[model samples]
Target: MAKIILNRENLFHNLNLISKQAKGIEKVAIVLKDNAYGHGLLEIAKLASEYGIKKAVVRTHEEALKINNFFEDVLILADVENSTYSHTFHIAVNSLEQIKKLPINTKVHLKIDSGMHRNGINKKQLKEAIIGICEQNLKFTGLFTHYRCADELSTDFYWQRSNFEQIKQEVKSTCEKLSIPTPKFHSANSSALFRVKDFDEDFARVGIATYGYLETDTIFNNPKLKPVMSFWAQKISTREIKKGQRIGYGGSYFAKKDMTVSTYDVGYGDGFLRLNEKHKYITPKGYKILGRVSMDNLSINSQDEEVCIFDDVRQLAKIHDTITYEIITTLNPNIKKEII
Candidate 1:
C-alpha cells in the first residue's frame, strides 16, 4: 500500500518563510482550502494552531467548520449557499445579492474584483455592497481582492494593486459616511506575498507556500522552502523479464536487457500519472516506470522492498506539465498519512 509522510519540521520551515515575508501584517491567514492541499485538513490545522496561526481560509463551510476549533477565525472563500456565518466562521461575500441575503449580524468579508474577474463584486457594485453591509448590520470583518497574474513575471500585478488601492479608498470613504468602522483589508496571496515587497496589508493569505511550493520561479531571490510531503510505496510483487520481452498493458516498453522489475501499489488510481515515453515517471533510485501505468499498480525496474514515489512534488509536476498544487492535491486522501 502507498503512504504519505508529513515532515513537521518542513511544515514549520515553510510557515516561517511566509512569516518573514509578512513582516508588517497582523496575521498570516493559512489557506487550507483543499484539505490543506491534500496534506490532511484537520492534521495541518492542528499543526498551524500549535504554531499560533490565528486565522485560516477554506473553500466551503464544511471545511471551515472542520478547522474552526483550531483557529480564532476561519474564512469561507466560496459556497455561500450552505454557509451559516458566526463569529468564528466568516463568509466571503462576492456579490451584492450574496451580502444582502446574509443573516443580520453574520460575520462577512467583502471580495472585490480587482482583475481576476473570477469571483467578487466589480468596482461598479463596490459602493452598493458596502452600503448594504452597513444597512444590514453585517459584521464586515475584512475586504480583499485576488490578483490574476501575481505569480507571473508581468506588470499586471501592479495594475491589480492599483485597482485594489482605489477600491480600498472607496470602501473606507463609504464606511465613514455610513458611520461604520472600516474593515481589515488584504489581497496578498502566496505569490504576491513573496513577489510584492510593498504589500502592506492587514493580513497575508499564504496558500501553496504554506504547503512548501512556489508557483513562480522567475523571481530571482526567494526564501528556501522545504517540501513537507513525501510519498512511498512498498513492492507488492517482483518478476524478471527477458531482454526482448514486453511489459505492462500496452507493451509500450521492451526490455533491452534481462532485468528485475517490481510492481508497487500505486498508479493512476492513487493519483500517480500514467505517463508515456515523453514524460516517464522515474523512481528516486533512477529506475523508470515500465510501459503504461495500470489503475492499481505500476512496474518499475527495482528489487527494493519499498520505493520513494516522490520526495519533491515539483518533479512530478514538471513531467505532467502542471502545477505542484495539482500533483499533491490529487493524491488519494485514503492513503495512510503519517506526521513525522
Candidate 2:
C-alpha cells in the first residue's frame, strides 16, 4: 500500500534545466555518482543518455563498471584501481604511483587536492606530479578538482579554488610541452555553478543539481531552476482518535483530545527514517505526519484532508529533521517509485 509517485516529467525538466546552465559547452557530463543519488542508475542514467546526455560520472571503480554495461559512453571520473588497459570511460587519478602504473593509452584525468583534504594531489606537489605524468605519458586527457565550497562565499571556498588556479597554470604549461589539448578543465560541483556565475568550469560534475536541488540560497535563489523530484504518497486510511489514546511505537505520541488521524503505509524501512516527533507527511490529497514512524507505516493527523505525496522534499525534511539528500537516497523499495 504505497502511495508514492515519481514524476518523470519533472525529473527530466530538472536535468535539462541544470544542463542548460552550462552555456555553449559541446558536451556535458551528467554525474551519476551514488546511484544517480538514489534515483536508480539504470533508469535515470539510461534516460539521461537517451535524452542525449553524452557523458556521466560515478564515485568508485565498481560503480563505473555497473553503469558501463548499460551506458557504453559513460565518462567515468573516479579512479578505477582494477580497470584494464582499454577500458572505456575516463578516470581521475591522484598520485605519482597511479600516473606511473595506469595504462598508457587509457583516457584518464589527473585530479588535484586543491584544499579539500579528501583526495587529489597537493599544491606543493603539483609541478612534480605533472612532470612525472607527462614524462610517462599516461593519457592525461583531463585535469579537475572538487570545490569544497560553493554553498557559501568564504575564505574556505576561496582557498580551495585558489589551488585550482595554481594547478591549472602548472598543468597548462606541462600539457603544452607534452602536446595534449590543455586537458579540459573542470572543478565546480552543483552549488558552485548554480550559485556563483564566476565559479563556472568547462564541465561541472552535477549530481544533486540535475535533480533540481541547489544546496544553498545562492543557487535556490536562481529562478531558472526547478524541483525535478516531487515525492508523493497516498492517504490510505483515516479515522478519529479519542482522547488519551497513545499513538505509534513507544507511545511516542498521544491524542491531546479527539482528533482525526490518517495512516500512510510507509515507515523508516521505506525511507521514512525521521525520528523527529514533529515530522510532516503529504498525500496526493493532503499533508500530515502524526506519530512515531514504524518499519512499514506512519501516522498523520489528517483533519480529513488529502494531498498527494508529490509535494516538495524540503517539506519532508523539515518534518523529519534531516536533509533532502537523506530522504531521497535512503528511500527503500518498501515504497514503490512509479514514473508519472
Overlapping backbone residue pairs in candidate 2 total 21
Please list the residue runs of candidate 1 whose C-alpha ends up more than 4 Å from where it truly belongs after superposition.
24-26
The global C-alpha lDDT for each of the candidates, from Candidate 1 onward, is 0.86, 0.68
> Residue by residue across 1-340, what tens digits does model 2's lDDT show?
5544555677777666666777633345778877666666666776776666666788777777776755544455556474473355777778767777776666777788887789887777776776776677556667888877667656676777776887788878877876767877888677766665544567777777677676665524663555555544456688888999988888878788998887766667767565666544554455456666778767777643334554567766666666677777776634444556
What pairs collide in candidate 1? none
| Best-matching candidate per lDDT | 1
Clashes of 1: 0
**Per-residue lDDT of candidate 1, residues 155-204 (tens digit):** 89989999999989988898888788899999988988888766588898
Candidate 2 Cα errors over 4 Å, as ranges: 1-4, 25-27, 69-80, 85-87, 134-137, 198-200, 218-221, 232-240, 256-262, 278-284, 301-307, 319-322, 333-335
